[model samples]
Target: MQQTCVIGAALASCLAAGTALAQDDATLAAVEARGVLACGVNAGLAGFATVDSNGVWSGFEVEFCRALAAAILGDPALVDFHALPADGRYRELVSDDVDVIARGGAWSIGPDVRRGLDLAAVSYFDQTGFLLPVELGVSSPKELDGARICLVDDMATGPALDDYFHAAGIAWQPVAATGDSEARSLYLAGDCDAYARPAAELSAVRATFETPLAHVIVSDGSSRVPSGPVVREGDDSWANVVRWTFNALLAGEELGITSANVREMAATPSSNPEVNRLLGTEGEIGAMLGLPQDWAVDALAAGGNYGEIFERNIGENTPIGLARGLNALWAKGGLQYAAPFR
Candidate 1:
């Protein structure tokens, strides 16, 4: 009887181990078999994720997805973009409807600790602020006490707004909208006194207005908004691929590897050990991640470096025209610093 019990216990333990191993590599195996990276993006937020007149998607987040595809599939075009509503992003990831969420979603304690999701990395550092029509002549968010504010219904901003108002001992009404477009519409139509969103997105929203100069982003009541890609929990391999892809973007910028110069640098190895390892000249870092040695090269080729992606999408020349306040490289006095490639 004792021998039979031991055998049965061993069998059950082995089965449990096998199940855990399968769960770990499930996402990566599915992505490989599908031959495409499934990326979730915002429906239509200019400068972050938007479709052009020709139905081509292009933006900072879009470029990240393309880079990820390039790294994994060796082709930047092998990406299936899903336009997801803000509230449904987490559900989509959990349900396996999308592999990764690259929308500009703020990382908060609820999603990270409570929900079975992981915010991989901070792609863009932003702050939450209020946008008001200049006609109101409101210089500060505090001046709008008891006012109606347009906010996204399902986001960290909802709770953040509530906390801010409660702490300030102010009364306000929330005019919830399904998405940024709806929020902007309500704000523009005078349904709300102000529109609350990330300052970067507020600029994008304002650009769509007929008279962009008529609106102003309030400088008060701001909170840190660190947005990034999100993936389902318990898949460290898949998460690493997404996280390191973002790091490669930042590392490429720091190493001065641009789309225009990556080919040349790859062909001719440099004396810099970090640059060589990053470009697949020295180490097997890519192989460690189950990718080709030239994975970073493909990523950089897809969207240029991180800096180039920003400059092309939302830099001073673009309508959004955001300066690299906290998004710049750490060496250049910004917060964007990547882990060592080694």
Candidate 2:
């Protein structure tokens, strides 16, 4: 039989005639049975994931895990954070070391669907960028000709940087670093003229510098990457739960229901039916997902909505000081609107 592609807004990949896309819920069962959510996160990237001196895990990745736990187990603190290494995170996920691995590069064919893992959703829209001294007077990436650049080894940005500079006929000296922290250390020690990494991470790293005002980040559209949570394939049920957890965060933000106001909002069902349905006072949305009606309330309470999470952890007011450029809600002209709860 000849195969035909059925691509559309609904279907992302081509389905074969005899392919069986199973919806196993073993991961979900294990998570519930074990009474905790085991989530994989980066070992120690400032804005994304970090373990503080108090043995508390906190950051964007941390909040996602906690929210997932809140949805599944009814408590945000019922989480086991497994700090996975950069090169070994996928292997750990494949081995079932954690229920889900958060904070991957982007949604791509090989790393996601083709590799037997599903990208639940794009949690954050991040782009790779360059951090250089202000004195360099370089406002754009194309201006970095013959400059020593430090980049973390084995990142997608390598090929991207190569293509960007090669096409522009720009030459740059490459300084090797093992990871983001090393790149920051080397850049701070003046081992290289610039350090390259994701713009959010660059902002977080730069904020820790003694002379933060002396540095600047150069971002380009070509380096944009869609980063989010990754789960093993063949489990659409579990993936749906993960995706909706993110949606609830976004929905909370879009509906003006923040962590501070979520309890009040849930306690009193206002004129908005969607808000009532989301908070579990009106509809069976949680029951449909095999969760309690108050699941969203717990998730929202774990952290604030998406906007609150960004602002608290890495927004312009925070130490990381990243602006909500493309992360704002769709109603506000950003690309972060959620699908309907119904």
- The lowest-lDDT stretch of 10 consecutive residues in candidate 2 is 14-23
lDDT of 2 at 8: 85
Cα-based lDDT for every prediction:
0.87, 0.84
> Tens-digit lDDT track for model 2 on 241-317?
99999999999998999989899989898798889889998989998887889999999999989998888888888
- TM-score each candidate: 0.94, 0.88
Q: Summing lDDT over every window of 10 consecutive residues in candidate 1, give the lowest-scoring window.
A: 1-10
Instruction: State residue 76's C-alpha deviation in candidate 2, in Å.
Output: 0.1
